[model samples]
Target chain A: MKRNSLHRLLSTCAAMLWASFATAEVTLNIGYLAVEQPRAAVLSNLDPIPDDDGLAGARTALQDNLVTGRFLGHGYEMTEAVVPEGDDPLATAKALLAATRFLVVDAPAEVLVQIADLPEAQGAMIFNTSSGDVALRDNACRANLFHTSPSDAMRTDALAQVLVQKRWTDLVMIAGTRPQDQAYASALRHSLTKFGLRLSAEKEWAFDADMRRSAAQEIPLFTQELGDYDALIVADELHDFGRYVLYNTWQARPVVGSEGLSAVGWSPVIEQWGAAQLQSRFEEMHGREMTSQDYAAWAALRTLGEAVTRTNASDPQTLRSYILSDEFELAGFKGRPLTFRDWNGQMRQPIAIAHPRALVAQAPLEGFLHQNNELDSLGLDRPESKCEAFE
Target chain B: MIRVATACLMFAQPVLADEIWVTNEKDNTVSVISTETLEVVQTYETGERPRGITFSRDFSRAYICASDSNAVQVMDPATGKILHDLPSGADPEQFVLHPDDRHLYIANEDDAITTVVDTETRKVVAQIDVGIEPEGMAVSPDGRIAITTSETTNMAHWIDTETQQLFANTLVDSRPRHAEFVKDGAELWVSSEIGGTITVFDTETQAEKAKFGFEVQGVHPDRVQPVGFEFAEGDTHAFVALGPSNHVAVVNADTYEVEDYILVGRRVWHMAFNRDRTQLFTTNGVSGDVTVIDVAARKAVKSIKVGRFPWGAAFRPTE
Candidate 1:
């Protein structure tokens, strides 16, 4: 009878030990905020915009983080806040910051800046996954704001590297009137000057007719005035007329930038360096191809997960310092470990030069050397950055 | 009459030298280097984008991971002909033959799973779900534990061989390219390519015991990526292949300190030791050549040109 009682006592002790172990597991909460914008009309119906663009990537990354966290007795949870079109995004951002200090934001540059300047968000770490404005990483940079998306300058620099390698130096550009299109055009001009390329001609698209029916008739005539060039550059960020420009140019030159062979942060054609598995996983989860915004948001949440895994802390201050440190390296499936630049808080990565079908090359190409990092050749280097927040 | 018979027997028994087989990724071919001649004897065609190669226990059959073809092809070594293909999941990058000499654990990069196929039965025994982008595979000496190191997930997943279930998972550095068990299965070592570090774990407790990084003078730290490593005959010393560093690191197994760096060809990926462990051959990817290293001298003796983008190497013995 005494032995039986001892067995029961030992079993009770074991159960309590298990309970204590379970209680020790850490739970981390992250926030995903996206300001919904109206979808732009596309000339081609083959490539439709996905409704769950940025959110799907965050969800997929949450699953990836949980897989690793489960092994370490940690739990990850994400709270999503999508402000509809014409809604007050600031109020939603303020409420999200109140709950979670870590946020992955898919919003415009202006909205992102406003969110970063919030008093409640001072101690928060905000990741910008959508905006590509260069000012976000330069003059208007915020200390807490981190950008995973490639800036306009970075994309144009990538294109310029390929052009220099292929000897397509002389080029002409056709730009739209959209603000993004103008920004990209200016960035392209800057990169061309930096890379010693010549802009033979430039034009602005002013046609309001439907491009689906009149692209072949109107585009060649519109491009005829520019004369012959090595290649044609288009700066239509909205995908409005870029699709119609390809194979419709007057000089029979290759169409690039925003259509045909364009520079991107991520593409479905990227299968090397273990990116195939990521693409397959995203496709299996969403039943569609992964986009650059999806990749940026995925990278943002993964950055937070990696920081949490290393430091075992949930506070934004600790994670922010750790993320910017030299020790942090995130495996971004780009054949390299992605690191954040201390000067601008932009993630350093290789830009994919690809079309819709296949990947042509990656930027920071051969012979383009840098004194510090080869990736610095693609974006605003430390000396060129104007923001003094990091200092 | 007896003297004539003895002479005929002696002529029949010709000495056969061992060979080193290397898979060329871009060329889609296998370059065979003879140990005696230390030169390329012959080259055999393989499936598209071959990366990993290994030999069966008896050394009569060879297996190649035809990555782009999505198949693990078996080859007859004596005739240099492909026999058949095993049912490997999509994009098999690396695989390891179990000590039992039947089960092959293949890391399917696209499917994120470790596929176990029984060579004798020509069937898949189990498909174990692992982390994302599984690139490295290793089996313990006793055939009880198998490890799959996922490059993107940065974790080494331990599988129980008997139950085909994951028993433990341990984190490693970023972009882990290879996993190895040493010290009589007491320690597990994983090399991270981009993180430029090798993490050692205790096999019993699944806890990280030691972590070490590599540095070669005049080579940037970012380029010092640890990929494949081979231990000396007694496991006292180890030679690690540093990818893109153009050098192989000699590490003290006990101290985990890099003792020396032997400059090889450009972009060294993997290495193989001779039957007697006297010579080492490194497959250089960019230079498309193999650097022969003298074991005791710790120097590169010669560079043997091979196919384009030589990736994996395996030693074959012939008695």
Candidate 2:
């Protein structure tokens, strides 16, 4: 449309190419923007009410991951810049990415997608550090973005596998009412069915005009302990009383619900294999524990770090190709080695079952070994996800 | 007379300190245990999964690693009401007090990141990516470097504490869980859960210096997970928490030998020593007890059942 002006401008730039666009540090500045501090009432807002303080829990997850990966060489360095508390994160992110071509965030999906389409986003890659929404992988999938957090489907599938292994085929579903929460509950229900489990009872928690009233009746109604059913499956993504539902059920059996025993990409107590060493260094850095986000982010970064290190270049396309190549070896967090799923860039890893005290167990438990390894059995299999990105 | 008594009562109340004085993770509350009282004093309610706990080096505040909430519930030690929440990586567990204590290092479990919070600002100034499943963290005695053990990868990473960039990631064995840089800063002893051994590494080269293991039965080969440990540099002796076995293996770091094994309780998680180093307190998670061990005798002096799943303990009594 503007070939005449483009020709003149291009000719001028071609003449001065060496003068203006000189080689540079090619620095990657990562900005993690959040309302308030990341740890405050952190999962608290998972619901209207905040869960217990997981400071110790999140400390081990400093890198946003504990996944094991090592760089072969060095070239790309990830630098981080934080926006002041109370500052508008989107604005801060836009400005930061304008200068730096790569970004990683701990914000929600709406904010993530918002920044993905920013004018400055033309030649950048964004890693979603939070927001496990599945839509990001499908309908909203963008070539320039990647997600380290597991999709809701991934988490649900993991939990379903744990249920299947335990043979806790009958699940009494106590679900919190939110669009996302409902979607999560429904997905788990579908997974339970898909994996050959059934929902014996289904209950919902409506948001109360008054928050206190809802908190009061939530856990008690969930009082059905272990024996009432094989297990209590609560899908209150919003912590609310999901964390409380651990042993607070009627039947008094082992609970695998929202807050307490949910499955995830990583766990802090997984000292098996070479994970402890990673945990140690992270603690030394942040002076605390690690979290789920820490594991995913670390894997994503390490994955990318290894790729860039191997390629020894800042070219994103080249680095991405190196990662997707079959020769990559990622052995950081989850002890056993792993690689990226071709369809979606999701790291194929194990789902750990954890409480605040210690990790209970990991999914695809010991004996349920599969052809490709039991750990990979937890999340979405290669056959299930429809994303053609990997294909 | 009644009005006078009420006024007196109000004035007699103690002033609360600014930090989260004490916490019990399994209990879902923190006991604002006064450092002044070498005893269980008071308790405060905190967010969910309050496991790893530590105070700012200055004692201005206390941080609890709430894994379930994916944040560190910061608290005023005085009132025990949460002061603010720091966005920590998820599943935060253990923490290391910076030698300066101005900064508190967080081991976030879920997110697998190490978050450094400036105690003065009480905000995360740096969030560095580390290995998968980061757990126990320790700062070098010289305060030059920070070390975290990512459990899943079974690796220990050394951070240039000043820059917070991961300078090196040293691979160890399966399930490398916890670490402690020896008091002298010469070497670091890292524990492995699934690997079931303690690896000693030269802090500089990150090379494996030595490894110590158990020589007895009942120690499930994989279950002989080495968790919490304490050692003196020149001193050849150290103590390691043997997971699920309910025992603390006393080892000689010089020769890489297991000198003795002292049984504690089921699923022993962590341990801390008294100022004099004469006594050791190890938390027995499954048995719900804290075993007090006499360092010299290498024997369990007492087993005190504190609460449901007691995880951490400390002695802040100044000499």
Candidate 3:
């Protein structure tokens, strides 16, 4: 081809591309509300928190959404509000609600409830992407709020199912001092009972021993009292001493719970079913591996993207109805299309069972079956849910 | 001219003395299942983490994508012995041999590049940078358009075979694990494992024609993870391996309607039809076996235990 003709072709194509970009009509704004959570006190020397954790996942989802959104003449915008410590979350949520109908919240259970109760957030749909509090799905369930974060109950059940499958029915639980740690312990106990597993003993770790300072003597004494159990389950939401309990256990047992071989929403180690792609993308964008909160935020925003694409509408009410309806299902890279449970408004997804290094397994493990959906076995099923108005 | 050539090749297809080759990912071996007996006649050790497998168009050599070894192993089909390794880049998970039988397009997952190799010379011809973790590779029937589905990018990138340039990037659902062109080459179907949807794209228009979602009673919609697909020639039905759901969705090609869900082994990955298209075999990853389906009955006829994790499969037709 001659240079003149080639230049003419390039100019024609560029003009057509520009014209196509000019015709986009729909714009969807997704708001992310999170607190700049302080780094948790860890027994290990490693830094536990990434400066931008959950927000990075949401940002990736926005880019992913825009990739498809462009073809449909839809554009996506993200609004982020990171609340500082002791600040009023209501103010941040209010500002976000005023800007967009869809909000992905990576806040605590109390903050989520507070935001959901705001009149400005009445008709808007908010996704709980961080809090794993069970009460949010129980008595505190709001009509407008949907949870992407797997509740404490879900996480415990996932671990329990894996234990039952592996025939590790005998458990020795180590509970932490924090309120959330106690709550997780309670949920684990309930999971054990439901799954027909016997809890050999429950030891209270007052968390007074900072393993970093006095681990050589204290860890040995702390884990000295133990019966013959197949697994040691630790509930340490504070990350106080869970990491230290793995190699220091008196009994030769596999440790599982918040540390060791634990159940997760997402882990960097997950490579099967095309999770490697997601991990690589997250790594390229954030310069680090994606955490559970990042995955939860991504899933929430991806759910919004799916609903909007399916319905071809940005209306919050339309999206809510579609998500609640049988037609609303979002594939969340958990080997299935995740859907919202009508009763609790909790998105049903397979929980990833992993240790710090590798994925141990996925739950709804081989034999534990449910009548409706296998994932239903992990959380509060329809018959047991106490939500006010279940569809 | 292509149609006439294809007709001649179809008529000249070899006899039914073929062997089924299953790539055992964990064991680093290939299980050769006899087509006549439906039994593993032999297992040959290959490179580490053998995944995708294919035969040259003329059936002279078998190429196996040894992902962990970061190379594609060429082996003698008759002897089941490794001959040489193709110059595959980092983590060559899946690949396809173009109809010309000359070029091999491999998805170097970790490198985020599709390495095109000249099979005859065993040389790297070209490497096109694609989306992150590019897994699935497919070449159109005409040998003109090549596609690589970038799993993380969630887009099926169409590359012009001649120019070696990506022309269109059609965004689909999440985590697209595999791509296949229909019989006529008018459409392309890309399976999104995480999204649980198989999006069909028009090859000419570069538009999404339709999307199919699988629903098996008692199986969560999210667990209906479509990974690999096999289209039965001359039939309207195509079989999709649903990961972890332990079922194969039989979808009607013309109408885009899923006709039936045939139960199979756990975590079914990829599949291949026999020379006669009478039997379809699926690699069940978790179960570590291959489920053979009788196409006429649309049922899983037998489960053959092969290896720790049987991933990809192909049939070697014997003359």
Q: In terms of DockQ, which candidate is strongest?
A: 1
Q: Summarize candidate 2's per-residue lDDT along A1-391 as a digit string, tens digits.
A: 3222111111001112122222333322333333234433222454232221122222233233213423222223333444444456666666666556666666667777787788887557677766777767766766567776777776787777777777888677778776657878877876787678888777776555555544535566545332367777777765665765565566666667576677776666776444655666666766655667766666666555555434456666776666656655465545344556656666656667777667777665655545654544555566666566445
Model 2 misplaced stretches (Cα beyond 4 Å): A1-93, A118-123, A207-227, A366-376, B1-319
Give the CAPRI class of candidate 2. Answer: incorrect
Candidate 2 per-residue lDDT over residues B1-319, each given as its tens digit: 9867754554475342111133455677754332222334466777775777766654456677776677787777656778888766566787787898677788876566888877667678788877666787988888999988876545687888899888888766555668888848888888876556788899878888887667546432434667777763355688888877677888877778888899888878777666567777777777876777888889997776556666665544422
Q: Interface-residue RMSD per candidate?
A: 1.9, 7.8, 4.0
lDDT of each: 0.88, 0.64, 0.83
Candidate 3: global Cα-lDDT? 0.83
User: Where is model 1 chain A poorest over a 10-residue stretch in terms of lDDT?
Assistant: A6-15
Question: Which candidate number has the best lDDT?
Answer: 1
Best by TM-score: 1
Q: What TM-scores does chain A show, candidate by candidate in order?
A: 0.92, 0.75, 0.92
- Give the DockQ of candidate 1: 0.49
- Model 2: DockQ vs. true structure: 0.09
Q: Per-prediction RMSD in angstroms?
A: 9.0, 14.4, 9.5
Better of 1 and 2 by lDDT: 1
